[model samples]
Target: MERILPSGFRFTPSPAQLIGHYLARKLCDLPIASNTINDADVYACVPAELDSRFPSLDRFQDCRYFFTWRMPLAATGARVSRKVGSGGVYKGTQSAKDVVDANGRTIGYRQSFAYFDKSGKKTEWLMEEYGIRRQVVDGTKDLVICKIYLTPTARRACDRR
Candidate 1:
């Protein structure tokens, strides 16, 4: 994957996580499952209602568009164990809270994610929200996300980069 930087040089999370935990909380409404075929391939178990709830998914799924997938945000609640089943990527309950951005007057949110690996091991990652006052931008104003694969120790080992 190519890392897109601004013309002058700038950095920001793809999708802008605007609404932060609020959007993350929205993910809770959408179901996600690890592909039994491949652990790296996480599948969004989007129900039919989601088609109406989030029309963007349809547009993103369009192969004609370069953007073939939506921003994947997922977490399990108390029932996560029963949700993911076996051969899953991450498991455990996750929660997000919205917070104001201290750096600017614009409102922003952040989500704190906690979950366990397939081995019943605990893990956590902090995801900063990006979307607000803005919607979507091609490679320019959009938030960039790179999925880095970590070891059991949770140390970065490799990624799509």
Candidate 2:
């Protein structure tokens, strides 16, 4: 809610930066370069509710990022739950796809989802979920980075191929 940067500033970190740097530091409880990305119960709220959580920080109107905890769903083991909020569910368009660094080293995993309303109607909202590799941290990871945005027109172009 506080303005830490100049007006009209934009913070669009790449997938590498999201997982390799910020998220990696997050797993270790380290500080990041900016407070633009916030902590939230991502799965507990519909994508539309995000605006209220961070407000319309002018420049961040189109994209919002959050650090959320992944709850273990299995009865006896580790299985990150995907149960979304009552308003809707995030239907996975792609599962844990490998995200590699520029040098071709696997840094983390990325999952893509399209938001569907309670009635099962797809919405324009989309999300990219990122989780870290053990190489970045030494233990079982529970926290994740969630980036939510409207579906880009470029996505339709990609699908054309």
Task: List TM-score per model, in order.
Answer: 0.29, 0.80
lDDT of 1 by residue, 33-59 (tens): 211111111223211222233322112
Clashing pairs for model 2 are: none
Give the 10-residue window scoring lowest on summed lDDT in candidate 2.
132-141
Task: Please give the RMSD of candidate 2 to the true structure.
Answer: 5.5
Candidate 2 regions with alpha-carbon error over 4 angstroms: 56-61, 75-79, 134-141, 153-161
All models, RMSD in angstroms: 14.0, 5.5
Which one wins on TM-score? Answer: 2
lDDT of 2 at 4: 70
Best by lDDT: 2
- In the range 11-118, model 2's lDDT, one tens digit per residue, is 777888899999999878898978878889888878888856675444324678899986665543244566677867777896688989999999989999898988
